[model samples]
Target: MIKGFILIFLLGASATYCIAQHNKAKSAAIIVTGKVLSQADSNLVKELFFDGLHEKIVNNFQRASTNFNKVLEIDPANDAAMYELANIYHTQNQEADAERLIRMAVTVQPENNWYWLLLADIYKQTQNMAQLVPVFDELIRLSPANEDNYFDKANALLMQNKVNEATAVYNSIEKLYGSSEDLSNARQRILIQQGKPGKAAAELEKLVISNPSDLGNYLSLSEIYAKSGKRDQAIAVLQKAALADPANALVRLSLADHYRALNKPDDAFIELKVAFADPNLNIDDKVRIILSFFPQFADYKARAYADELASITAKTHPDDPKAFSVYGDVLYQEQKYSEAKEEYKKALVLNDQVYQIWEQVLRIDITESKFKDAITDGEAALAIFPNQAPLYLFSSIAYAQSGNHEKAIAYLKNAADLETENKDVISQIFSGMGDSYNALKRYSESDQAYEKALAADPDNSYTLNNYAYYLSLRGENLEKAAKMSKRSIELDPGNSSSEDTYAWILFRLKKYADALIWIEKAMISGKVVNAVQLEHYGDILFFLGNKEQALLQWTKARQAGSASEKLNQKINEKKYIE
Candidate 1:
């Protein structure tokens, strides 16, 4: 009965008569017969339909619904009005109302293909897969020659895991229009999902046999076999593909993948080398394969293989910047920083627009203490990516390292203004500002910068050590300096420089005995005690009344190549000058 009632209430019956015939109708009629009679105007229904469509287009759903409801009121079998109202409800996510109205619409105008498509779309949107199958069946009945409708029905069946029914739909497609690559692939996928790899492989084999000259079909079959864990079968199929087209890079790449999966890395590299040598294989694909080996770069053998592949890539695609980029990445991963920088520079010359390569160039320059290059490259990168905070930060670091404190502060302040969300970058900016201010002998500004740095990152050891050492040097805030210097040592226990700072702070606090103890500890902890540290130890000894030993220590400080004017005065006077 559901299928037979193609056009329910087809007669031009009066509204009262129709309503009286169905007492079980869910809702009251929106339009009374009196209104229809008054508006008994020409093309009244057509006017209302266009009005509804205009309202819907302008997003006036209430007016649109009113117009559509009036259309249905005058003519209860107005499928177009029902469809428009259903689309409105669907847009509002009222799927239940959408489904009900669309069902009525499709049933009222059985031959309207648009109405049936809308019904199918509503079912699909709601994921009402149980009901979806019947809608597609109705569509196929309405549009018998449309091949796409059958495919939709097959996909709907597949969504419900009804593999057998889905297979029947695919077979129907083949029967209607002879076999195609699309149909074969769809059937192969279904069979594979149904745990019928053998059948899936056979399905693809038919394509190869039907068109033996198509190398892609052979690769497709080999891929299916590989996915099914048939290593030997995959290799044999790819070998056949290679023999069919010996110059095909795709075949060589596939063979490499199979060999790599089988743990024959040597065989994989050989195949990759052959593939890389083929100019027909584009550089983008070669770069993708090279990047795919990134996860395995930690292994020495894998790194070696990647190195060899990069060499082949360079030889094959020497003019491409991406080739040099890949070569740089391999060298970067191996910690060959200098070599990596050269490769990155080569890539930059070919293409300077790639931000990642520019970043690499700057990173290696910074890491290898080539600050001049970092500043030059980072400045160029900034012209392209002006708002990039890290570029400003690296430029700041480069300027700071080169003893240009004013330039460093300018770059750090610029970076601080641009960086909002990243607290680490902000903290580093303020810390760099503190160091630059201290270098310029701006004590008040230096103090403020250190405070801001600590507020952002309270445990920044570098900032703590520098701030504390500067305070101790000025002979101010001795107690607070002692605390911060001690914290820095605690944060980095094995850092001899931090230990020396703490000892110097203790010396400034006039705790001579404690200062001597800490300075001795500094000397022992340090790998190679510097001249400043030796001088500090001499000062501590002199404070403890060991004048003779202090002179010997001061002489040693001079020999250690860090003798200041004060230290020379102290040794010549043979006493604590202060």
Candidate 2:
């Protein structure tokens, strides 16, 4: 979700304005055609003007512009006023006005290090490195002792692809400060960039040896080693760094990432937990590390981490209710149902404002088939976050399972109202409702639910097969049943239930020859081995003058658990003697 240029945008905006202002001030001096600052009493004027300028910073560009104009009117050589005005205009994105002021500022204060560095940052933002190179040169001349100045100058040179110049400045800094840690670090980066990773590694090693306790230096060494295919060395360096600064979560996180990359997921998770325990660790990192546990371990680990996290938070914020909800999630994931219920109860006790958590508890109860408990939870969830879909869906299923068809149908209707666009879900709920009604022998209500499902998806294969089979069983709408059965078979030619429905429909219509053909076809479809289809086929055969084989088929069907007991009796009793 986060990207590379975000850092640039965060820190670059102010620096960009500074550089743009400097460029403008220089051009303004050329245009004004006069000395921007007078030699007579310049220091006294600068001191007096600097305080007023500092105070004027709070003024907006409109007020600041008027004030700057007054300063310039009093003394036409007031370069400081011009520079301040330039900064204000640049901040306002009035680039042309800012440019006019900055050109004058730089012309008046050409030798100023601040003016030159500010110009360099603008050039960097605009990617105008050619103009930036000379500004840094002037900057270095103005402030040679400022180590950061040299470092910045080298970086500007590096950006311009002037590698040799960049390396020379870095070396000069090193010679001046005799293996200075910062310069040493900078030189190592240059070495890596120039394809001398071995040299970079050696340079970092020397720096770490001299500054044994510098965590940044050790991290640098680890990075170099890892990049250079020396992972063992990288791990050793991180371990040493972590040992030196045991409280640094960054080092611990790096160590975990390193272990994860090495195929030691368990070890990685341990380091992650350690990092998570550190109060100084970023909350985002802690959450990420906790989430990275393997899915198989999520149940146990999320629960344990949630418990630890709760304890840690509650130690300070003892009255917080959200922590209990977090704990409940972990327990629920682990299927510790009673413990989870207790936690949810604790959460509600602390605050009854958690609607979603109530829904979660209800879901858990529904999953465990605690129908009465589920209704209580669902009612609570609905009271808070009214019209929540999961609550209705789960409550409907639970009510249906508990043999409360009226409550189940009511809940299903509510679910349908809430999720109108989920036609498939609505269809499934209606189909299930129909099945429940049929079980209660409420034929008209069952038929209406089935019709509702068919209206949602006219050719839904499962619904077609089910409704058609129901009709054939009731000995009604035989023609319509045959059409729906054929449609089901067309939808999924190899589906066993569809095949069984088609064969059974043919047998119900007493089309014995056609029934035999389809029963054989259903067998060849290879999706089902239904005993009912086998027995029906035997009946067709017996009706078609194949008595011996018909008896054999019936015997097989009976062994296969067909409703063939009556057929077996009739065959044994010679009831079909013709």
Q: Against the true structure, candidate 2 has what lDDT?
A: 0.71
Deviation from native of the Cα of residue 66 in model 1, angstroms? 7.3
Per residue, candidate 2 scores C-alpha lDDT tens digits across 94-193 of 6566655654566556666666655665566556666666666666667777777778778878887788999898888878766677777777878888
lDDT of 1 by residue, 362-432 (tens): 88999999999999999999999888888888899999999999999999888988998787878888988
lDDT of 1: 0.84
On the 0 to 100 scale, the lDDT of residue 462 in model 1 is 88
Per-candidate TM equals 0.77, 0.58
- Highest lDDT: give the candidate number: 1
Residue pairs in candidate 1 whose N, alpha carbon or C atoms collide under 3 angstroms = none
RMSD of 1: 6.4
